[model samples]
Target: MPTKTDEERVPNFGYAGFRLDAPDASVAWNLQRGRSGQNATGDALPHNPTAQTPRRGAPPPPLRVSNPKVLNYLDDRCRVHKETINLCKSVLQRKSIDWISVQRNDMSNPIHDVDLVISVGGDGTLLRASHFLNSSIPVLGVNSDPTCPDEVDELTDEFDARRSTGHLCAATAANFEQILDATLDGSRQPSELSRISVKLNGLQLPTYALNDILVSHPCPASVSRFSFRKRSNTGESSHLINCRSSGLRVATPAGSTAAMLSAGGFVMPISSHELQYMIREPISPRDADKPLLHGLVKQGQHILVVWYNEEGAVYFDGSHVMHSIQHGDTLEISSDAPILKVILPENLLKQGS
Candidate 1:
């Protein structure tokens, strides 16, 4: 793995995340797993394609995305994506950074040799890229569609119709060059974002969620039944609850503003080391007392959930990774994952604080 001490380490740039083809359609993302069959050249090749012939002088950088045409729906976003790529090309030409083009689905692609990773889309892009990178490599997010108007015409309008990801993204395509310059010059410090790790049946999973994890019946309309307990530092079960609800969510502070917030969960400050759990639409029987539905999971507290639904599943970061659960299976969640280093403009870093 390339570290800060390696002089040959170069910045790696990529674009990922979900694409909204139309205002009325539900947003979707690439869900492919492991080493992708597609190469950085956007061709059907192996993970490391050495035979890809660069065209002429200054060959275009590797770009990986399923259906790049999805950007065509929004003229501004399409332009932003193109402009960001052009800016990256210019920087690559002027600097020693190495260009990395990868598909959103290639989570096991080789990127450990990279010094920094630049995600060129929204929050989803950064989230996907995090799975493919080493913890030591900091990530920089570029908000491609920052021009979306601040005000929405209708309260019921879809969130995507109004703003594109200005909240989660730190740099705009227009000023990314300046931010990159400062980052390379050592004038900027990266923000450290905490992540959540999950274990199934006492074995660790391959991925972690930077946002939140959803545990529920695989069928959306079905009810989920589970019992969970908080294991204290002394190895004793401190808090326990039996839940009958739509699902449950475990989130980090950085993920508080995402799905958890939409489900009536509170937002934690970006720097919080604490984790939170919430039950979704719990059901109370006529004679039984309702279990505690929501609460904070302190820094070292461990949450263990026993599955009662025969066909339940656990979704990490909104389905980026899904693990099937069977009756009596136990899933553990904690704040023990690697700390993610996210690059941000110094000014925005202060604003986050």
Candidate 2:
């Protein structure tokens, strides 16, 4: 047997992506009962006497889909996603690469030891995978299903509504092989994205957020009440400011293009180390001056927030991981977190472009 040369040996990679379809038992049961008069498990449901009666001025019932396979076939997004995954796997196998596949939602998967991580879905999949990763390993995001120009401009009922934006993905099925080769050969450079370091009552959180953190009431309709103050590097503190708003968001530069931009936050340079906070829908006081709604948290500075709500939660990255807080609890957010190494397109790293 011939020994493999250094060039022939490939680094171990961890693969993660979204499933083509998530099976919902309740949805399947409803579809089966509505169309075939039987539940998903093949049990007949009791028939209602007035089920066929049409109410005046009522909206029509939703179209029932009895065959999930047919639905999947008609959905171009699912087909494209599956094809992309297959293509990626074929390329890896052809190159004799060492890799391991793991479910994106499984937090217990051992992914830290891998040399590189490849996320095969849209930005959501990459974000979920990032939750389990540290700064040591670099990640490459592949947009499994990219939207075409025709699809975006056409206004037709036949168009699929579930297309992926893939804002964070730098490669698609067409360019996956070339990009992967470049990444493995040291020709491609990875960007270091700063993360937010969070502390609850002085105890640091184990996970850092590459995107943004949302501090809000558990119920979306309820107001978020909190008091916050800025503490400088020299330990000097600013005056406490109370706020009643929908929520508060603190984002790193990498996350500025996402929810932060939608909420009127500034889009910082991708390489910036600063963290910005934005107050969402603040209820202003008519008698007092306008509150400091948004500001930047530089290195060596941190924001301290005192939760006043009976029950509140802090969401990291997206809605995946969260921590609960009660009244009198303190939460601290800073820019002093570990950095995440990601392979990004050159255009995405440009300042103010």
Question: Which numbered prediction scores highest in TM-score against the true structure?
Answer: 2
Off by over 4 Å in 2: 1-74, 156-162, 286-291
Worst 10 residues of 1 by lDDT: 19-28
- Indicate the TM-score of model 1: 0.74
Give all TM-scores, in the order shown. Answer: 0.74, 0.78
- Of the candidates shown, which would achieve the greatest lDDT relative to the real structure? 2
Native-to-model Cα distance after best TM-score fit, residue 197 in candidate 1, in Å: 0.8
- Residues 152-259 of candidate 1: C-alpha lDDT, one tens digit per residue: 444224323343464556677678778777777878668888888899999998777888899999889999999887886678775567888898899988899888
Number of colliding residue pairs in model 2: 0
